[model samples]
Target: MNELQHETSPYLLQHANNPIHWKAWNDTSLKAAKNENKLIIVSIGYSACHWCHVMEHESFEDETVARVMNANFISIKVDREERPDVDAVYMKAVQLMTKQGGWPLNVVCLPDGRPVWGGTYFKKDNWMDILGQLQNLYTTEPERMMEYAEKLHQGIQILGIVEKNHSEAKSNPNNIKPLVEKWSKSFDWEFGGYARAPKFMMPNNYLFLQRYGYQTQSKDLLEFVDLTLTRMAYGGLFDTVDGGFSRYSVDMRWHVPHFEKMLYDNGQLISLYSEAYKRTQNPLYKNVIEKTLTFVERELYNSDNAFYSALDADSLNEVGVLEEGAFYVWKKEQLQQLLKEDFEMFAALFNVNDFGYWEHDNYVLIQSQSAETIASQFGLTENELLDKKKNWEQLLFNEREKRPKPRLDDKSLTSWNAIMLKGYVDAYTALGHEHYLTVAKKNAQFITDKQWSTDGFLWHSYKNGKSTITGFLEDYAFVIEAFIALYQATLEESYLHQAKQLIDYCLEHFYDEEKQFFTFTSRDGEQLIAPHFETEDNVIPASNSVMANNLYVLGILFHNGYYEKTALQMLHHMIPNMDYASAYSNWLNLWLNQSDDNKELAVCGKNALENIRKIQAEYLPNIILAGSTKASELPFLQSRFDEQNLLFYICQNKNCLLPNTSLETTVAALKIS
Candidate 1:
């Protein structure tokens, strides 16, 4: 029986009708394996993964392969997104056995669910051959299978292993710069991003580079940062017509991307671009930031105000054949017909020539030249070209909408949605836009009402009016981080109070006193083969790393040295791998922040909200803003309320300068003193 029909995961639903008899991961499935004395074949993948879809079509759909699987093994289909804990254990096992790991991960494990052999995305012939061999070896040579499982299980458990760092222990702030310069050699200065074929838009690397370049006044570094951002915005990685970035570019030039847009990627990119815009006031960054948010609101957002996880990579084309990038790619004839008068200029502006070609005479709509430059070539003023361009984009966008839409994974995750929530908050802070703030507060309210429990716990995922799975450290850490951002955005004390409660809950449940770091699962959740502590940065910053940053920021908010020390210790354990710090850029950023001169921009009076809005218009990453319309006792807000004038003051480390009765003098004072 296919138990996947009972599962809530979209990835599982995508396979619910497979020829194989599939069971969703549960005690019943594992128990069936043990009771029947059959090997367990655990296949894990996410809904939007392109290769996962390919494998499903090739192997899982074949009746012959289904017979082999159903006869010899108790087959379980696990959605990596919904059951990441299970995926993590098996993925680690696969990576240990084979040097690489990705989804459509197939792991052949013991009846007890201890992984013995694993690999990803095999063809029908290859799948049958491997399955037959594994089944034979398991039954005929039980001792060999047991040996492999025992050792591989131990290896997977120890992979996230943390170690002490002498560089961090020495407490020298100067040590990080040389390593940053060394690691930067890999950057693709001309094309943007780290030099590679499949370029992921790892937002942390650019965030670190931009901040480090600005703080150190390194002109070359700053130029590299700007070049990267500009090129990426112009590239196919960014959706020019619609909005939101794809997963990554398949080519080194960022010309053609893997069209699926993950919520986490767009959310982090929005936050990154928001900060970049604040620092440089670049129109390109602001444009991309706003457009991406528009895409989120239009597509990824659920009617209930919660964000969805992703959009599938494959969709039906005009002829209804399922194809990758079908929704995004365009034939030249389609564009030429739509923009008959403006076709020549549009083609030139977007590089619809052979240079922009992807596959089958289609272009991904990547911008090769800016409108200003293209306007000159077309014998038109910039404004005239811009007017034509805007009109053309809307027409093309509307036309594209009439085509088949990609499948949306409607599962809402606490961690991913929280990241998007922080993105909106950052967008509001950078742009001083009320709409972004409204969106952020709306999402926050929805999470509090839906995913969160009245008893102060969180659920991991929600879909179709049902929330399932226990919340992991990531859910707690990111929500805690988002709540802090919310408090800073609104200064609503309830937000702070909620953040504190979440953090306390994390400390009580996720923290390991011996390791001094968080395990990925809560103490209350079912333990995996081994408890995992994710501390490295990948596509997402490690949950533990994000938690440490929350502790550091919360320490500043509450003047708690103990919290600060714990955050410092977490960094200390990671700082020895200086070259790897590029991947750990979030941790390094937190470390650098420890020495940053803290600024408190306090606005107190009946008109404090207006003053806060004005003060926040500036890009002050190192400052904490406190506002009160009346008297308050909060540490950051103590005695800040004024009865007479709209008083403003600048304070540093508990020493405040003379209070100003006007916002003008206060803004000027912050300029130099």
Candidate 2:
């Protein structure tokens, strides 16, 4: 086995026995690079990355390629999930240098850890050629090579400064309105999604639009979110045959997908859709949530109740061919053979054709016909047709299970769990599903018990009973957000207390007093070139933005003036970046629409608790709920509150009104705003 066998990350362990001598990304490896005066080759990827695995097999596992890498460079392996801060830093560099970046990120850096050149994957022979060229340049043109390194290092420094300096102009409220208008104008009205060819499941944007619609009562905004959610629910981006959403659509219509499923994306989007359902009372939204939860339970859930990261996009088919959509796609002949007399009906319903939906004659599972059309065509009632479709779905799921499943990235990450915890908690409230609450509580407990350190710090990821990577700001921020949500759902004091403790730790360790924003890592943690403060939205919301929203909500719930002040300060700090809100809409949303009236509904005492739960079961977006009770008594309200509550106060603007101990008064108070 290679030295990577000793590493904790499953991604690294996957390469344990490869011919490559892979060293974990650490000071030891960096020091070795410096000592040997060798160029450092850093390859960054996560476990469920299909291309990462392919690259590993093609290059890292090949003896000749390994020899070339070993002879020419000091190789270091990084699991992007384990060290997102590092990944973010280098990914920015790669994107700036090459105009694009992705995993398996292959970069060649100088001994001092400054990246000089990089790209994603390269063929074995091509890689050898590049290695020879780089080596020759370093040997013969040392000064030119040093100059190139200096330029790259300076470029990175400039990017850091730019990132640090981004903030919306707070001098004029008019500044943000234009940006909001710009985003609104960019909405794809006909399609119900954003204007783009390759569409992403951008829950953040949809969520922002939902909030915008509530604030402005714009029919366009509401329609955009509603149409997008419904279309996505009926499209290939959503696994109509299984459950849960794929990562993104490869086409403009959301009809074709890249096929990878990520837990964080599913978790966040499920909550968004559930909240939309609550607002619209749309059965389609509810159905989407149900199917998504089924996917999570069947595929992503681990034994510990913590969710896995993702499922690979690629799976081997029956013929042993590595096909992208093989598991999901169906051919005309195959459907006819399987369904017999029902084949035509099912084919028409699912859009199955001889030509198929994808390249290479593959077919993606889709809902081409409306429920009414399918019912009429099949000569059955809507309920009967739905039941038949459900039965067929089960058949497909069972059959797919028998085939090669996509490789699971089983590593448990604190940030991801925090995101999913909120998802489960929100879904529990929206659907009144007890099982969702159970999973959320178990995962929260797992994180608090296993990932928390004695020093009040949190680790990022865990695998095989070992947790090693130091937690980043996202881990602390998102987990705290999760705890706060769990507290709201269950009205348990402990979760709130724990969340407050985490907030304190973040303030002490990660907060930049001068900058008024949280740093990506603690000041005393491992030294990078600069302490990053991420404000842009990616697949998940930024740590800074999520934590800012978290703090704002906590302030409202607890009536803590200081927390609200801190939140405002953080938003104020990020105000200048609003010009680019289209790209960072998730972060910008927290600051764009100011809520002048935040109603707080506080239900205290035993009699009011049941009513409070009933109120919570209904979607209340702008209100915060808190119950003052012992943690032990939380279990009785677990089905209602779902195990995290006490000292309940639901308010806005940090000025909670008098606590209402009656359900009627609580409802009346909540309805006021």
Candidate 3:
């Protein structure tokens, strides 16, 4: 075992027994690199990454490769989930050098830690050759490597340059339509995602599109969102037998998933499907939400009610080799033997023949036909088909459990847990599930008790009853957002107050005054090669974008003019940099809030809580909610609380429509229904 044996990250622990002497990223390892004048190999990947495991087996375990790495370099293993700051700086370097980047990110840095060379996964021979060449280059002429490292470090520093746009004209609903038009050219109208292979379920993209489509009354865009959501849910990207989504599909059709399930993806997806359900009342979306939450609960939910990070993509197959998708994929013979008389119907519903066939006679269950279509073809009722489907799932789930399950990355993260908590809040609001609300509150309380500190800040990661790692901006952003959602759901002033406190902490620690944007790492945290402004929306929305949107929401909820102005200023700085709408979907969502139709749904009266619940159930994308059952000092609810009757006021920028007692009439006035 190496120094990594002492690490808490599962990814670092996976490398603990490697022949290579791997050390976790810390002051000791870094100081050793500079003291010895040895090159630093900073390889970053999460535990669930299949290619990361592959590289570990093919190269790090080999004695010859280990000798070279151990002698020439000080190796540091980083779980990207745990140290995103490290990953961000090095990833930017790799992207600058190669114009692209992915997991199993391997970078060779100078002794002081400026990256000299970097790439993603490489073959053993290539990896060894590159290491040898780089070592020889440094040994022969150290100045050459230093020069390149300095130049690359400079490039990395300016990667996410955000210049403040001093335009007085704010981004409105119509101003962004042309940006969507530019983005629409890449949309795979037939496949439901972008026109590309390896489709990621970018939940926030669809989220923004759904809201924009509905608000603009664009039938084409709305229909496109419906098609994308339905196709994604039906595809093999979604676990038909289980309940959650894999990370991304290897194909555009969403027919072949990469097979790792991430907490962040599933969490955002729940919010997407839940909101879509409210708008369209699609039963399929509800099923996806319920099933996905079930998957989360069964696999990732911790004893403390917070969620774990992820499940690994690879698991031991029948042959005892680690294989991707082994636990989920099934052979035709296995399905035939299990289903018997129901086999034909099942095959038709989830394409089991040629369409579903993968390598090695395995079939990944992907629905090509809708349940209604399959039921009509089979001369069966919807209820009968639903029963058959449930039975088939039960049989398959039981059988699959007998196989070696995927390894769990059991460490919990503050940002991801908060995202999942928000998911539960959305599920409860949309479906009126008491259990969902109960679970959300429990998790929220757990975060407060365990992850939060008495000094008015949060810890980033928690495991084994210990919280470590100072909170990053992502942690504060998502938790504040989740707490606001909780306040909206229950109208608990304490949750709102908690969010306000966190927001103030972020302003003090994470905000960059000159850039007018938040940094990814807090000032209190360790400084990396360069500070990153995470602005792009990938699988998870960018931390800065989430923070900006949170600021906008809280500004309205609390009626704070200064907060609102700061949010707009941040948005102004980001507008010029939004080259891709999908990449900046969260930012665009904030832009949507600036539209004239946006409302502050303020309720204060005897039945305030009841009315807030009803208002949230409707698909009101432009509404920010706040209320109190009793008299409150919040500007939105001040002097408006009536003890005798429930009153709902639809206000915009402190101007109000006459308070109405009828929920239906008030909701209809917003033109939501």
TM-score on alpha carbons, each prediction: 0.96, 0.91, 0.99
Ranking by TM-score: 3, 1, 2
**Tens-place lDDT digits, model 2, residues 1-673:** 7779888777888899988888988889899999999998889998767678788777888999888888878988999988897887788779878999988899888888888788988888888889889888877887787898788777776564323334544444345557778777767776677788778877887787676666556777788888888788886888887888888887777888878888899999888987897788887788888888888888888887778888878788889876566677776677677777877777777778642376666677677557778898768887888887788887777766777887678888889888888998888888888898898999998998889998889988887777778899999988988898898788677898798889888889988887788889888799775457787776688888888887877765555778777887777766666665655666556564355534555555554455556787665665656664333333212322323333344555534454334555556555523
- Per-model C-alpha lDDT, please? 0.85, 0.76, 0.91
Deviating ranges (above 4 Å) for candidate 1: 165-170, 596-601, 645-673
In angstroms, the error of model 2 at 313 is 1.7
Task: Give the range of the ten consecutive residues with the poorest summed lDDT in model 1.
Answer: 164-173
Error of 3 at 133 (Å): 0.6
Give me candidate 2's TM-score against the actual structure: 0.91
**lDDT string, candidate 1, 34-117, tens digits:** 899899999999999999999999999889999999899999999888887888888888889889988899999999889988
Error of 2 at 104 (Å): 2.1
The runs of at least 3 residues in candidate 2 whose Cα sits more than 4 Å from the true structure, single-residue gaps closed, are 160-176, 354-356, 377-379, 629-673
Which one is best on TM-score?
Answer: 3
For model 1 the local lDDT of residue 72 reads 92
Instruction: For model 1, name the residue pairs that clash.
Output: none
What is the Cα-based TM-score of model 1? 0.96
Write down the TM-score for model 3: 0.99
